[model samples]
Target: MPRIDRRSFLTSGLAAAAIWRPLGSARAENFRTDPFSLGVGSGSPKADSVVLWTRLILDDASAATSADPFAPVPKQVAGPIDVEWMVAEDEAFSKPVRSGLYRAVPEFAHSLHVEVKGLQPGRWYFYRFRSGNAQSPIGRTRTAPEGVDGFRFAFASCQQYEQGFYSAYGDMAKKDLDLVVHLGDYIYERTYGAGLVRRHGAGVPSMLYEFRDRYALYKSDPELQAAHAAFPWLAAWDDHEVTNNYATDRAPDAPNPAEFLARRRAAYQAWFEHMPVHPDLAAGFDALRIFGHHRFGSLLGLTLLDTRQYRSPQLETSASDDRPERTMLGPAQEEWLARTLGASQAKWNIIAQQTLLSERDTRAGPATGYNLDGWDGYRAARSRLLDAVQISKAANPIVIGGDLHAFYAADVKRDFSDEKAAPIATEFVGGSITSDSPSEASLAAALAENPHLRFASDKHGYAIMRLNDRSAEVDFIGVADRKQRNSPASVFQSFAVSDGIAGVNRL
Candidate 1:
């Protein structure tokens, strides 16, 4: 057998044995607590397959936390451990459907990425993992359909570990949502936000182990854990996953390219280990592929984007900002999006990217201010994407995002400055899960200045979108009080987009 590199092994498939490790080195050690402390999750659901994930965190391994010295460490695994996984028609595993063995090795952080294939289309299944005497929590996952049918999913972003509680996930889990799309900021790299009901329990991480520790801290939250066990999440990241306000190869905080790319490599690898995404996504930092498309029956087509990975530096708000060369998704991703969006045949097309797709004028009076980190900074790039939306003629193309930390529903105008220009598509920007939102004064100005924006909220929450052949309805579900452990999630606002229409109606 040929020896495959780690990246090559992952890209080829979830063959843990291909990495070449001595199975005899693996030993049986009974764990007092659940070794699967990180919880189980599934993602990348296709009509016949879905990727399942879980990480083995032995109680005696090593210190995964630096901020909290008292935190317990994990037990080290000397060799490969075969984790038995089973999928069934019932949660009890009485009617087992698929069974497999995943070789877990410490080289990949003892994380298992099993791509279970041959599942029935448009159906739900229960799955669990077992290794010796230890067992993982049962997780629920579903496959996409091959025909026209209604699909329901929720998307949220900006979950800073130190700023607020994860009651949003707790509340969202009770909603019985079919799918969850996290648009970025899954973990905060900084600790500067105010009103800390919880802390990251560690310092800023720049190394592989440090980043892994940061992820371990977030995964310890029971609410977050329950949410992951409830539904498979399509996860993406913005700046906070690495550092604040970073744009591609340019790190404003770290001027040296070598230093920042090293940190970026660590962050990228950690994200792959924690997320239940495709095996190819963990190839490497240089060729990591997190951007892709997922379809739900034939009613909706979702395009997951990686805007932060290959964007140019945030330019100053001046006439020079309109440079035609400025790119957000980069040339390759832009071309891919154009080709993919142009060919989409779903009843409702959803462009799932980080940050608001529509323009927002922040300054109250004559002075104009735009978030250079968003689409406003790259005018020509936004125009080209809008052109693709126009040319593709996707019916009721709706953009959903969550980097702004506020709720917004607007008509995506070809030209934000022009009112008479009919809307080419609609957008719903969900508020942050627990991260702080823009102040009322700032949001008030944003709403008043941007006439295209129909609704705005400063609450912390996510967006639940229901799609069908006739129309698509989006409910902005907000957490009543994230500071409270038992925060209630309610529909802050609702809107609808008729089939083939280019505008939204407030519901």
Candidate 2:
């Protein structure tokens, strides 16, 4: 094998070069067509390791495209099969740094999650999986760096399959980015909307196989596959991953606790099967906690939260649920966050979670209203996080979230009722990938009622951030049109937050 330059692996052609590759002449098994059509992905980056993932298309059960996303999906079980995977210093697989054989099993839908470790920190690596003569797409991933002068990443969420196309992800695939953070609502459980560009059929997922079929339908998209293959991602779930408006063991329509828990269990199992999280995460399906912290050297600390799993039930009015005992992060997650914040010495601290963090008054005129489904319903819980930041003196705290189907920029205040209070941190909520947003009339009223919310948009897209030692710059990349596939996207707005600033300023 010849020496390969490490930098050459990260050039502009990174995504294109690996876009097409014939199967190697190693024929261990034969298939009628490409079995790697669903594509490959990686996540959970560490200093010496990162997780690589791929699901084999062993049968034609999930290959057919139906008119509805929820139409009954075919199912078959066959796995405990051998899969060969390698992480190379170059895209050519010439300088193999780590390689192994992973056993794909039926328990996890034949999905492979290999946490390859002992890797060089902050370096780009190419990976792929092979079964017999079939080769998966070449995916690019990187281990967390020990240090950095600058870095760029994007955060997005809420891609409703039937609502629109995945052009946002397609646009992201062409950009240079180290990480991608998906802030939940990966798959909508039910179909409910108007003027939808597509259809999810006429059903909602509930059972394990139903959920698996739903995932197969979404993952089959080529644009989504390309984005997954381009960069490492940190993903979490929200209400839709299970059902609409479901809280910790509670659902508005689910009158029976036992039945609800069973549905949630299946949802959790399916989420674990489809996501590229740690293998051990599967152990906590019943406990309803799926959150963790990651670091990119001294530059940044990221805490991915699970707001839907262990949270209090929904509140219709913000003031109705401000009880001192109402919790959002739950006690354990809150404790972990506090401890993590206290110990973090990074210049930038980020809370990547779901929904809006700052208060959003949905009413107009001299009246106070709040979206209790958010921080408003659990003011005390929000206070706990803020208190932890203040007590720990966490540096440059910033919060980015989704689920609102709109973009929002706000300064989270120590006290929202008091306009004179100082902001404790800055918050940015990126637009939904394809989900619909509130009416223009609703957004206008929201802006008028809440002066703290600097900006909000109903357009669909993602948010890109470039961070350096001195500041973090963000751009709202909006899709020009989502009613059609292959639509164009561009940055319509930009904002910046200086190192010591506690608020976002329009750039």
Candidate 3:
């Protein structure tokens, strides 16, 4: 492994030496096929750096003709390919800031990850990629601000291709957001429903090639590509990215530990290759960890959590399952969260994670039933986390989550069962981008039993949050129909949480 210098990675004028041309290369010639079919994306923005990503696709004929639109098309050339990336202040390549040549190798599916640094903070920049004579679509991304009065961003999750079209992303792409947080379920591992709006390539993905094909299929969507190209994204994964209801080295459906680990490794590799995450964070399959913190000047501190990667195996919901020994974030990440929250000086400290943190009894009776996959399963762990927030006196702690396929607004309390317990943190769980959800009546019945839950909606859409020094305003937006490609989205509900307040006020 080579050391990466932050300053030289972008400013170093080494493109001439690093650029690798193909055999019998001339000046340039237009080919009969296109290679930039997957499009370009940028993400994991920092104060002075951002990661740009794109994959080479030689044949996209299958994407246009196959009934299963996401089917992976075989590459025309299979070897090391030279890719050039450039970041400029303007849409045109007039004021170029960073330019570099990267070799997209076959082992990594001919994908290029250019970690361009030495950028101005709190500024938007345009970037594009070049391969021979082909040019990729221009993408816009912004670097995080060093200090600012306020910021606006959106958080979304659960985009199942077969369930519905990615219409929500079309709306999200139009939003004037500074950042986008994706709280898991980016891709569904298993295929579902026949004769649907769209279809997955084939069966469930368990190998490296299968996982890579799945990601390529999902990323090939125009709507998804638009959202990624529009802004830098901060993403984390839940079970569906690999398999449903999987925990630390355990797959509930496939109980074999060795087989599940292999599948997880493949899934993790594919995720890293496709996502626009920084190279340093891109670890091997066995050591993959996506939990980290991002600070938006002094206004907000976002802690992205990884709930699925290092959790205890899911057990039957019972009193014993709530023991302190069971962990959702694992011991190390829990401590890291505590330390990060304690040291954070931002006005708002947000936990951008997966699933609902508040306990919701789904049985609709006193006989309690919990989704062992959520924070409800690790009751003691959730309690400890809340306790840490209170003890540290964290500034205006807020929790944003997804993966329940429904929108929920709730107050996190010391004891969810105790009606008198004061709220310690405000939690808002956004709905899926395109996945199906339970009916409104079904969610309403569940809310009747769970008083802590203030608002509930079984619609498909995303959430937009505006944070400032005084308060954080959240609008839970919903689409009218998921089956329709051009479904209209409207604000289903709105809530405001004042600075230092632990509960949300309905607007």
- Which portions of model 2 show Cα errors greater than 4 Å? 1-28, 60-77, 316-321
After TM-score superposition, the amount by which residue 24's alpha carbon in candidate 3 deviates from its true location, in angstroms, is: 14
Lowest summed-lDDT stretch of 10 residues in model 3? 1-10
Q: Which residue pairs of candidate 2 clash?
A: 68-200, 68-201, 69-200, 69-201
lDDT of 2 at 466: 84
In the range 27-65, model 2's lDDT, one tens digit per residue, is: 344543566767888999898999998887666454345
**Per-residue lDDT of 194-248 in model 1, one digit per residue for the tens?**
7788887788889988998899999888788777777778888899899988998
Model 1 segments beyond 4 Å from truth? Answer: 1-27, 61-78
lDDT (Cα) of model 1? 0.83
Q: State the C-alpha lDDT per candidate.
A: 0.83, 0.83, 0.83
In model 1, residue pairs whose N, Cα or C atoms come closer than 3 Å (at least 3 residues apart or on different chains), thus clashing, are 58-75, 60-74, 60-75, 61-74, 61-75, 61-76, 67-202
TM-score per candidate, in order? 0.91, 0.91, 0.90
Candidate 3 ranges with C-alpha deviation above 4 Å: 1-32, 60-76, 193-195
TM-score for candidate 2, residues paired by index: 0.91
Q: What order do you get sorting by TM-score, best first? A: 1, 2, 3
**Top model by TM-score, which number?**
1
lDDT of 2: 0.83
